[model samples]
Target: MKKSSLILASAGALLLMAGVYLAFFVAPDTVVRIDDRELVQFSQKIFYFHVPVAETSFVFLVLGGLFGAMFLGTRKRSYEQMSYAAVEVGFIFVLLVMITGVLWTRAAWNVWWEWEPRLTTFLVLTLMYSGYFVLRSSVQEESAKARFGAIFSIIAAVNVPLTFVAGRLDSLKPVHPKVFTLQGASMEGPMLAAFLVSMFGMLLFATSLYIMRLDLLRAREDIEYLKEELEVG
Candidate 1:
């Protein structure tokens, strides 16, 4: 491995360990109550990972779109490769979001699922990116696949913003009361720290994943090229 890769791998592993420590040990407790009865305390602890993964997924979603735009502008395969990596990373984070969100619902809402806007939006996110992968696979030609996939990726990512907007358009359905409530109020100290740590950890993890995946992809491409050269020779 190159020195940069080795250094980054070491740093990423350290950060991942630190994040685990901060989350399990340093993070404060969360409590949920009804009529002065403590129904959930430590159960709410999962919120730290849930919200952060969900938010980090959003960051990657936008990043994929930006890379898609760059691919179109530059007509380069590298940008397409980077965009593909970002989308894959984004999908993993989205899955984490769904898993954590379900846990939170079971803990706080006493139900395994709810038709909340955020939840629905995340579901849409999963589908949109899934379509990206499908579209890529359907094309047999490499250059054509990359070209068309870039277009589809850009379009599919638009659903993210649309899904957010659609959530607001629905005024009648039951929505999570987030306006001026304790929910939206500034997160307290330990809670804030836990949240920040979770987000930063996931973002760093995603970055590391992107680098590793990209390197593997480039290596595969090089191998394929060498094989083709040998066959011709």
Candidate 2:
């Protein structure tokens, strides 16, 4: 592993651990009243991790698209590698978002799934990105594969913002909880602090993964090139 990536990974892991500790122990539990009874929602603690992962996924996906645009403009293999790596890392976080979301939903809504606007839009986003890998593999030529993949990455990244705002759209009337608004975050001091720590941790962790994956892709390409040269010799 690269020194930079190693440092990022270690820092991210420590911050995430601290965030978890703060979320479970330092932050106050959400108390809701139902039928004259006060209930402490323990599952609400998942918010620190869930929201951070979801936002980190957005950041990576947007970076993938930006790198894709750069690759297209410059025709650089490095940018193409970066685009692919970011998307791969982003997709893993997307899956994590879905799994954590499902658990959150089950805890809050008493159901495994819901066809709410936010959830539905995110699911579509997931399916769209899944096709990115399929599109890459279907192409035979290397340049063509890269070009197509870049285009798909850009398109998929466009969906990220739409998915984010789906919950706020008046037409959608989404059931998903909204934590942030034009005013500010809906959470208190300690809760917000924990969430911020988790968010930064997740972003750093995702970036480290992207760098590692990009290095691996470059290594694989080098190996392939060496094999070709040896055969030619």
Candidate 3:
């Protein structure tokens, strides 16, 4: 591993820890009054991580789509590998988002799952990328597999915006709120600070993970090439 990557990973870890601490101890507690009763839901803290992970996942999914397009255009194995790595990372983060989302839903809405627009579309997005891996594996030829994966990824990215807006547009009330905005009064200062720190931390962590995974994949490809050369010799 490169020293720079290690440093970056460490920084990410530290920032995440700080964000967690601030979320738990420093951010103002949210108290919602229901029927003249004040309800303090600490589960709201999940927002710090959940929203960040979701945003990160979307960003990486877009990167995967872009790299996939590049691979299709240039027929470069490097771009293909990059696209795969980005999708893999995005999938993992999306899973994290799902888990946290479920927890938040249970806490806020008293349901483990719902057939709401956002959740449904998000699940579809997950399945689409999951199918990308399946399609890649089912094919025997490397060139053919890469081509299919690239095309599939590009097509799947069409759902990104839809998934993002589904909750906002749903008539059936969703537990997920549209908290993100440019308006200065939307969130408290400490809460915003914690959210921003968590986001930056997750971005750094995702970048480090992508670089490390790409390097590992490249190493495996090199080893396979060497083995083939030896056999040919």
Candidate 4:
């Protein structure tokens, strides 16, 4: 592992632990009043992790798209490798978002799944990115594969914003909670602090993974090049 990635991974791990501690111990439980009765919602604690993972996924996906564009513009193999690595890391976070979301839904809504606007759109986004890998694998030529993959990555990244806004649209009537608005975050200070910690931790961790993946991809390319040279000799 690269030194920078190692440092990031270590810091990420420490911050994640601190975030968990703050979320459960320091942050106040959500309180809701119903018929003059107060109820504490422990399930709200999942917000600290769920929202962070979702945001991290979006960041990585966008980076993937940006790198993909760079690859297409310059025809640089390095950019292609970065794009692929970012997407792979982003995909893993997307899966985590889905899993954590389902768990949060089950805890808060008493149901395993819902056809809400946000959830539905996110599912579609997941499927779309999954097809990216399929597209890459189907193409035999290296340049053509990268070209198609870059296009698909860009298209999939565009969907990220749509999925984010799907929950906010008035027409959709989404059940997903809106924590942030033009005014500010709905969370109190401690909750926000915990969330921020977790968010940064998740981002750093994802970045480290991307760097590691990029290293692996470059190593594989070098191996292939050496093999080709040996065969030619």
Candidate 5:
């Protein structure tokens, strides 16, 4: 690994551990009214990680779309590779978001699943990107694969706002928090600090993964080119 990448990965790991420690130990517990009784539920600890993961997924989603558009406009292999790598990273984060969200909901709502707007839209987006991979694999020609992948990624990016809006449309009775802004956040001091720390760590982690994956893909291309040249010689 490159020195910078290694440092980033290490820092991200440390921050993640520290954030976890703060969330479970130092952060104040949330007191909620349950049937007219105020109760402190330890399960609220999941919020520290869940929201950060979800937000990171959004960052990757935008990057993937932007790179996809660049690839389509320039018809460059490097841009296409970047776009694909971004989507791969986004997919991983989105999966984390879904899993963590499910865990949070199960703890808070006491059910495994619900057809809530946000949840449903997120699942659909996940499926769409899963199909994006399938579409790429089914194509025999590289140009066709890149073109289709770029278009699909752009379309998927357009859907991100819809997913977010769906979540907020039911704000009056939203199961999820309406806003995560720090200025007027419902999350108090220590809890908010823990969440911010985790978010920063997760973003760093995602960036490191994206860079590492892009380097690996470039190396693989170099190897493939060498083999072709040797064969021709």
Candidate 6:
């Protein structure tokens, strides 16, 4: 990889570190609507980082799939490695998103795991993409593992949009109470700045995580190749 890409990866890691602090300490507090007649007070600040990170996770997930598809089309190992790294990082972000989302849902919606469209779809997406790893494990042959992993990665990518749309087909979409307003005093300047910082950090963290994984995978392949050569000699 170029020095610039390496710098970007390092920068992303630094951002993630900054994001964690901003998210926990700097955001505002507010009341969240749980149901038609119920409301619960929550830290208003988490919304900025939580919502943005969730969205960013999905974005990375899609990018992962795109790289996966590109790998298939070009039959280039680098693209394949990139796709694999993307999915690994995407998975980590998705898990974080799910955890934070569940906490928010429990406080706001009064349920641990609702069958709401987005939530449900995310669950499915998690399982399917995770299975991509399992599928790779089941194959013993080198070529077979790569081919299957690539194929499943593509399929999982295709399902993301489909699941997102399916998850939103419910009756209880976001109402007015949870919505932020400029005229109202919900989020002001300081809170917004903190929120933005947190978001940027999370995005940076995800990028760095992916870069690390990609390099690790490439190194593993190289080692495996050397081992085979040594054994043959």
TM for every model, in the order presented, reads 0.87, 0.91, 0.90, 0.92, 0.90, 0.78
Q: Taking the tens digit of each residue's C-alpha lDDT, what string does model 5 give over 21-136?
A: 99998998777776899888777788889878888888987898999999999998999899988999999988987898788668877887766776776788789889889999
lDDT of 5 at 139: 97
| Cα TM-score of candidate 6 | 0.78
Between the candidate structures 2 and 3, which one is better when assessed by TM-score?
2
Per-residue lDDT of model 1, residues 122-232, tens digit only: 888888788888888999999988888778778877878899889778979976643122374547776677667667766776777778778887888999999999999
RMSD of 3: 2.8
Clashing pairs in 5: none
Model 6: ten consecutive residues of lowest lDDT: 175-184
Over the stretch 138-198, how does candidate 6's per-residue lDDT look in tens digits? Answer: 9998777777777888888888888888666656765324343333365566666666666
lDDT of each: 0.77, 0.86, 0.84, 0.86, 0.84, 0.72
lDDT of 3 by residue, 1-233 (tens): 77767988999999999999999999887776668998776777888898889899989989999999999999899999999999999999888877887887787677898766656767778788889899999999988998898888888887678766765675766455533332557477898999999999999989998988898889999999999999999
Where in model 2 is the C-alpha error above 4 Å?
163-185
- Between candidates 1 and 6, the one scoring higher on TM-score is 1
Tens-place lDDT digits, model 2, residues 1-233: 79999999999999999999999999888777779998988888888898889889888889999999999999999999999999999999888888998888788788899776656666877888889988999999999999999998998888667776765566745455543231345587998889899999988988899889999999999999999999998
The residue-level lDDT of candidate 5 at 54 comes to: 82
Tell me the tens digit of each residue's lDDT in model 4 across 47-166: 889888888888989999999999999999999999999999999988888898888778878889977665666687789888999999999999899999998899889877877686
- Give the range where candidate 1 is weakest over 10 consecutive residues by summed lDDT: 177-186
Tell me the spans in candidate 1 whose CA falls farther than 4 Å from its real position.
1-6, 38-40, 176-186
Worst 10 residues of 3 by lDDT: 174-183
